[model samples]
Target: MSSAIAQLLDGKALSQRIQTHLIQQIQQLEPQKGRPPGLAVLMVGDNPASAAYVRNKERACTNVGIASFGKHFPTKTTQAELEQTIQALNEDDRVDGILVQLPLPPHLDAVALLNQIHPDKDADGLHPVNMGRLLRGEPGLRSCTPAGVMWMLQEYGINPKGKHAVVVGRSILVGKPQSLMLLEANATVTIAHSQTADLAAITRTADILIPAVGRPGLITADMVKPGAAVIDVGMNRVTEPDGKSRLVGDVDYDSVQAIAGYLTPVPGGVGPMTVAMLLKNTIESYERRI
Candidate 1:
């Protein structure tokens, strides 16, 4: 008897393709009398992880030929000052998209600060208006992660219509919007959270299983249905064998790979596609504004 491992979903390749498409689209656009499409990223505090994320985003912008405006504040900065900076970015004509890194200093209100970005310039797609548009089935910017997930499915030729999708987290940033995006693709969606009873039983019924719960090894082999498409969105840090920290996902890759028909890896999976989609959204916002 032979056992076959699941096919790996390559997010890095897909992200590069998406970026290439964006670069071409951007080059073909009419050059206006204003500056290039600009993405303004606001970072508060000096969290190493947050700083790395912001720096990666800026690099991605540069790679795609999009202009970037970055604002970094010390950990002790007041909420009022941050809001003022956001307000200025919101009013700047050269700025096409505004993104505020998550997990701001405890004193700052992330929701309120995100709300300050105009809907048209919300690159992260977390603004109230953008979320509302997603819920209402209206035309607007889709959340980067959700959009990237959809892009992967399409690139891999996985049709969600009439499929059962189980989303293992209900986070606003990943789970909720992701479930909705799958539903938009005509898939029956079930969103599970910490309170859900018998999560393993629920997950086993899915044709597409997505784990975004932020807990490593939460989804094991028995939990995933055979031939199911698995997407691991968690990026939890865990101690490695070398006594160092490493990033892993919610799904137990070794165990689940034996059962799943398709699987996305941790760091190399959904991570790269996110920035690519952000560039896509920035270009989309630019075209719309122009």
Candidate 2:
């Protein structure tokens, strides 16, 4: 007997659709003589991952006709300097969205810098105002990864309403925000983290399981409920047998796929959707201004 294979959620293609839509909106906004929609990306330090992520965002901005303004601060930059940069971007009429890449230097106060961005221009959606809006069910830009995860579920026709959703990892970016979004969709949401006991037992009860924990292969086959839709948001790089590194998610893809009704692959799933949604948010910000 052959094992059932799970259907893949193609984030790359979905992102293309979002980018195309943004392009059309940008064309419509071009006739205006005033400031065009702009995204200011703040990179603090030389982290390879952050740099790569910023480059991808810049490329997405170009593809969607949004102007990109970038500020690179040395790793030794003071928190005040970062705050000043954000304030400048906030006051810049041409700038519509501001993103501060994560894993900032130890000396820098990430939250303080993030809070300095104008609430409306907080594209990464990490500001307290935006987070509050999400909690209150008020319309605002959501955290990119969580927003992408929700879009993936919606695009795949997996309505969370009345479903049991278990989200592992309670980080503000992915888990907590995602749980809120799921709750907004009327899903019974449970958030489990590193401290949660009997993690497998909690996960097995989920109709929709989302794992954003950075740990590789945290969610195994036994933890996955049969026919559940699993979205693995982790992208940890691990060395393979041949000694080359490969991107792997929290869920053990090979083991979980056999039991899952649908699954999103690492590197090709939530990652692409993030930038895509950023463009969407930028365009939406422009529309709101108009």
Candidate 3:
């Protein structure tokens, strides 16, 4: 392992800067726009982690001068009822963005509900229209998590152009979008998943190794290329020896930090940037709507 410790990518600080900029922008425009930009986040179940994430998003919205119209429902909320609620929010003139919290109850038709959201108001950028826009390299709302990852990279001058980037995970939310974004930045990207043979071999070749597999400590020092930028997008709740839980990312920070040239930590890294991007998408949508 290299003795040089990786340069920390302070996502919390970058997110705070974005929040400050958004606050100024909103303050300057809200008066002529007749109201602040509004975002409505719809939550379906009582999943503790999901609840905490929603609360964080809502609080970020408030900090940036955006209005929040969030609602929580029991796990038993019906699909039709949720669809109706989305339709109502879609037509609400005051609302510029709408996002449904993920991991909905098993019975709920998550995809259909996501499709029901109007493209312009799809805050999470999970709607088909936005995803299509992203795929086509057209301007539209971006998926928050992936966008956060990109923003953090650019902030630190880690250009993806002409680099070999390996993304471990295929989920539409992070890994796929992340690869596309990196490709858009002119990076040659490779995606590895559970079935990929010799995962470490592929990861070791990456100039930028991003692991969003949600498996704590999946990527260790040996898996990383020396001087590579390791962006850990994974969020897993792992229990310590004392039975206390903590958030961790896919890369083994203790080991990888000493090997990688650049690294983003678990709790304060991509997580804060995700919320910052959510607020940004809302503000952008509001601008277009007004």
Top candidate by lDDT = 3
Worst 10 residues of 1 by lDDT: 27-36
Full-model lDDT for every candidate: 0.91, 0.90, 0.93
Q: How close is candidate 3 to the true structure, as a TM-score?
A: 0.99
Top TM-score hit? 3
Q: Candidate 3: lDDT over CA atoms?
A: 0.93
Clashing pairs in 3: none
Question: For residues 1-290, what per-residue lDDT tens digits would candidate 1 score against the true structure?
Answer: 12889999999888888888888787777366255788998888899998988998999888888899998889999989988998998898888899989998888889988888899999999988999999999999989998899999998999999999999999999999999899999999999999999999999999999889899999999898899999999999899898999999999999989999999998989999999988888888999988
Q: Which candidate do you rate higher for TM-score, 2 or 3?
A: 3
- Backbone clashes for every candidate come to 0, 0, 0
- 167-270 per-residue lDDT for model 3 (tens digits): 99999889899999999999999999999999999999999999998999999989999999999999999999999999999989999988899999998999
Cα lDDT of model 2 by residue, 1-290, tens digit: 23989999999999999888878878888688365689999998999889999999998898788899988888888887788788888898788899999999888778888888888998888889999999999999889999999999999999999999999999988999999999999999999998999999999999999999999999999999899999989989899999999889998999989999999999899999999888887777777777
Give the clashing pairs for model 1: none
Instruction: Give RMSD to native, each candidate.
Output: 1.2, 1.2, 0.8
